[model samples]
Target: MRVGGTGHRLLHAETARMVERALHERLARLPADVLVGVSSLADGADQLFAEAILALGGSLEVVLPASRYREALPAECLGAYDRLLASATVVERLAYEDSTSEAHMEAGRMVVDRSDVLVAVWDGHPARGVGGTGDVVAYARKRGVPVEVVWPRGAAR
Candidate 1:
């Protein structure tokens, strides 16, 4: 799965759980031949997708948005993030700055291009933040990538 957006973390409490649960449910439907490429940032949806992929015995590729994990996210999620990196079959960095940086944005395009499935856990709204979650989704759609948008049902985007 090529994951996009920040709905995994920024949603309201229950909303986060709902989106996570939905992601898990969606992952269960993927075939065994599928390889899940997960970007490692200890936020909400991305981590949940990694866990689900691991549980399903699928191969995981951790694509970090930056060369160094420390520079990308906070100290708290670092432990879980490290565990993810360790378990991944392939670990790569974008050789850029944070996910929102220009360099990373170019890198993100490659990530999405490689994905057979795109799972976007957006908050049902346009991104007003740094990460190009919205941009990633748009790219995936434009490329005719199969996308499953898991957001609150009635929320606006």
Candidate 2:
């Protein structure tokens, strides 16, 4: 799985630190040339992992799952997302026709197919209408990709 959700809804500062530490330890065990693909959504687990990957000299491929930055995220998140995109080696826009449309599901499938590993920042459950991290995990699982899920402490719900 080349792309994964950042698990914004179920994370906090301490969890972010823990996740950063865990990912750093894990990435140290991976081959140095591994290319990590991430979504630039800087809410929860995703942002922390992206930062860790970059710090570890790993290349990042950011897949923005929205047509325009402004459409799906708040203005505050756009700046950081753009910074992540700028730092990434490759950036692919998933480009959706509608915010609530399922068309992006195919795009997700393609990203998953291209990725060798899938990491999700899950909160333990799915969000009702947003098609949250669960959607990405499901796609990766369907492809038999390796998955690493990061959950905040006490986040089981």
Candidate 3:
């Protein structure tokens, strides 16, 4: 099964660990042989999910929002992003040259399209910006994609 998710960028350390454990538990419930995870490898939840997938021996498929994704990402996120990209089974970089909001939304769309299940690490809030996690979750729901939200107790952005 293909799984994808959207989450916050500024997750607290305790919250990150909780998210990771939740992802691990979720993946453990699935058949490991055909497991494929799709993600943008963003700073917080995305990165945690990717790591969980890899730990469980699941393949990773990375979807970059734009050509300049590396430059546009926060500096703290760059290392994890690069590491995940290097380990990815497939890396799809959107045609956009710049990392604009449009590009981000398009990338989110692609993630939902490629996923059999969309895992959202949301806090039940409206989207804060054009292409935030909430927006992606809404898009996935609108498209009829099954979404599994993985926000653990005490988890905070």
Candidate 4:
């Protein structure tokens, strides 16, 4: 089973923990032996889901939005990003020269395309920009991929 992840980068401290627990609980229900997680390895929700996948002994696949994707992420996210990237079972980097909104949306599309299901840690709000979590969730729904939303009750961004 291949699963893809999309969610916010900025999260409240308590909300982050809520999201982490929610993601782990949801992911734990999957069949571990054949599980493969696809993600951009961004901070917050992406990293949380990746960590859960690893904890459950599932394989991870990373998709890079652009050649300079790593440099575009927040400095604080670099440590987990580096570790997740290093732990990925497969990594696919796009041909974009820069890590623009377009690159991110394309990366989201790639994740949706490669996944059997899309897991979203969304709060049901519209996307702040062109390539935010909402857009990815919308795209996944449009493509008929099953989506399991992992937003915990009372969680806030």
Top candidate (TM-score): 4
- Model 1 lDDT tens row, 1-157: 4443223444455766676677778777877466465555446667767777777767777667666546566566678777877888877777675445565456556667667767777754555544456766777788987777777564333
Off by over 4 Å in 4: none
Worst 10 residues of 1 by lDDT: 1-10
- Candidate 4 lowest-lDDT run of ten: 148-157
lDDT of 2: 0.62
Q: Write the per-residue lDDT of candidate 3 for residues 1-157, one digit (tens) a residue.
A: 9998778778999988898899899888888888999998878888988998898989999999988878988898888888899999999999999988888888889999999999988888988889888899999999999989989999876
**Worst window of 10 by summed lDDT in candidate 2:** 1-10
**Residue 65 in model 4: shift from native, Å?**
0.3
Alpha carbon lDDT of each predicted model:
0.63, 0.62, 0.89, 0.92
Q: Provide the global lDDT of candidate 4 against the true structure.
A: 0.92
The true-versus-predicted C-alpha distance at residue 119 of model 3, in Å, is 0.6
Which tens-of-lDDT digit does each residue in 79-126 have in candidate 2? 766677789887776656454436345544555676677767666566
Task: Report per-prediction Cα RMSD to one decimal.
Answer: 3.1, 3.1, 1.0, 0.8
User: Which of the predicted structures, 2 or 3, would earn the higher lDDT when compared with the native?
Assistant: 3
Stretches off by above 4 angstroms in model 3 are: none
Instruction: Quote the lDDT for 12 in model 4.
Output: 87
TM-score of 4: 0.97
For each candidate in turn, the TM-score is: 0.80, 0.76, 0.96, 0.97
